[model samples]
Target: MGYLFGPVLSRRLGLSMGVDLLKYKTCNLDCVYCELGRTACLTSCRDRFVPRQKVIREIELRRAEPFDHLTFAGSGEPTLSLDLGEIVSRAKELVNSPVAVITNSTLLSSPSVRKEVSAADVVLPSLDAVSEKAFQSINRPASGLLAADMIEGLKEFRKEYSGEIWLEVMLVKGINDEEAEEIARAAESTEPDRIQLNTVVRTPAEPVEPLSEEEMRRMLEIFPGAELIPDWDWCVPDRIRDRLMELLMARPGTLEEISCHLKIDGSDAIKYCKIMENDGLISRRLHGGKLYFHAIDES
Candidate 1:
């Protein structure tokens, strides 16, 4: 499962199976808020970094889970894989689940890259900055990757591609958040199906903190209709995934507490808890050696 991970649950895409294309940290940008830390490859070249047939073989092995989407994302930007189109096409042929790809929008400038990714059912590209200065500071993209070109690529992509484009904007307090108006302008120009605003929630490569919920609310004022993405932990759901979310929406719990709250056996409680944990739906913390499970903010 080197290239494949999870039939994880996400608020945006339910029961997703993640497919990583690029090797760990092989990216076009060394983003300040990257959860996976700094880029080791920091490349713009498109090649078969990993064997295409091998990845397809991996997918064929894990076909039982009814994943909502076969998401092309990994330790880095998916567009880095030159064989992305073939991968997307083959995955669709192998599985009934719709294919999706989460790209950083860095390689959209390449016609081949854009054409390759269009095979996906949905494309989620990001725009954290419309201005070059902001782009350099926040994303630190590869040399010669202009902000203007990336923006234009997205705009062109909007015209050519028919799939749903949900543009993501990741905010850091003093970095990109201060330029919300510019980000909105980019969003308007791109005209995606919807805009999703997000902030860092986990340990980052750089020293930065996620914005407060209140701050995110203020940001909504600028983006107008954009939705704020909830910070989700990996949840391992049991047989009843919906019930886990419903119960956890009220409050977080330990397996014992969740068992009591849902009136289930303690043995069954731990089993469900472990499932939800693996699914990335809920996060756990240890207190006095007891593991407590808590659902992340789904709003």
Candidate 2:
């Protein structure tokens, strides 16, 4: 529960358990519509964000749980962690579930990073733009990244990675939505196993609106094999819920903050918090019109 989040039902991967490789807000891009809010450390450097041992240990411990996929995801970017490949290799040896990494594909240009992700069962990489200007406006990636280089990296990864590769395109109303043809062209270049069309379902760090369902369907048509995945699931395993509550109690968080940090939905986080409060496992405090949760014993 400390580094790992739920056995929550995911539309893409059923009963996915998450592993946070980097600290909160450590990422390469400060995306406009990120569910996790602003990026605090928006650098492209690959370093040890979380100690390697801790991540491996958590994966080992969580291996006993019932999860369909063991995902490398969290509040920040997973690919930014220098030891990502080793973590994926170690995790594969430790668990029987399919291993996955949800990456923004900014670091895929590096051969080492591509090699690391190749060990996983599936790699879900994001390609929201075809042109440099659109990429800059949509992802708002760190200073060093070039959309062309990132696309090249994805193309390279497809050749080296034998595992399934799913390309994720997050559609923001006025931004990337207008460039559906370009986006589809870019996706075709990568030749991913699946093209996943997604939209902003949670509150974003910046004020960005979600695209309409009709627009999403139109976007899907552009990519022949692509599918639209609307965010809606909320179920969490009882044991995983208990573990998540324990972690949240140790560190207080707002509903938005909790969902962002945990990579779960806001309503789901709120529901779990209420259940924990009713069970006398945790308590909440109202600060500046927003509720913050903490352990009852912390008082």
Candidate 3:
């Protein structure tokens, strides 16, 4: 399961198996609350960062196993992988499971990028801010990316893509939280299938706080088709669950990596892993002072 990670339960998508298309921490935005840590390659350029054939082969292998969805997500943004469309097409050929792409929506302005995601059953893109100041404060995108351009890209993608487009809005307290009206206006202009309201529930790159439930509900009200995803019990397949526990026991991973690999959300992944640790199935360790997990009895 080098490239394939989980069929873990997701709050948004059902049991999902993830495909990592890029190496770790390579992204266009240096979001303030990124759980995966600081962005190493802070650029918006698209390229074939990972070998396409290798990623395809991994997806093919994972498809042989039982899973609900085959998702394109990884340490970095999936759209940054230039051959993403090819990978999606190849994946569809190998499995009947629905294919999805989780992206930051930075590159959706490009016709080719939109076309790439057009084949997927679902495309979840992030729009943390509608204004330039809010964008910088919330997403902290690369130097050249403008909020206007990103919004236009989302608009263009909505017109071209027929799949279920879920607009992800990660709200950070005091920053983008107060701009729900602006975000709602922007989302209305895009006309997406759904608006997933999310907030930071784990350690962030910067010292940011999450919005209150009341604020979240108010924001959701502002956006017509929005839903607030709360942390809860997720359903993972028996075999996949066992394997996930085994993997976590071997090496601790950030919630983002686990979610990307497991095709689940970071918050949900943390909840499940915490339960496992509490039951003594695994133990937590600190490497370089960052928390990780490993199996108590690997034998």
Residue 147 of candidate 3: its Cα lDDT? 86
Model 1 Cα lDDT, one tens digit per residue, 105-144? 9888888889988999899999999889999999999898
Per-residue lDDT tens digits for candidate 2, residues 1-299, read 38889865566775578998888889998889898999999899888977889878888776877666899998788988889899899999999989999999989999989988999999999988877888888888889799899999999999998899989998898888888888889888898999988998889989999987777777767777888776432345687576677677568876667678767775567566655666677776756534567777745
Best by TM-score: 1
TM-score of predicted structure 1 = 0.79
- Candidate 1 vs 3: which has more lDDT: 1
Output the lDDT of residue 54, model 2: 81
- lDDT score of residue 124 within candidate 3: 93
Instruction: State the lDDT at 233 in candidate 2.
Output: 26
Candidate 3 segments whose C-alpha is farther than 4 A from its true place: 232-299
Score residue 103 of candidate 3 by CA lDDT: 92
Candidate achieving higher TM-score, 1 or 3? 1
User: Against the true structure, what is each candidate's TM-score?
Assistant: 0.79, 0.77, 0.77
Please give the distance, in angstroms, between residue 50's alpha carbon in candidate 2 and its true position after superposition.
1.2
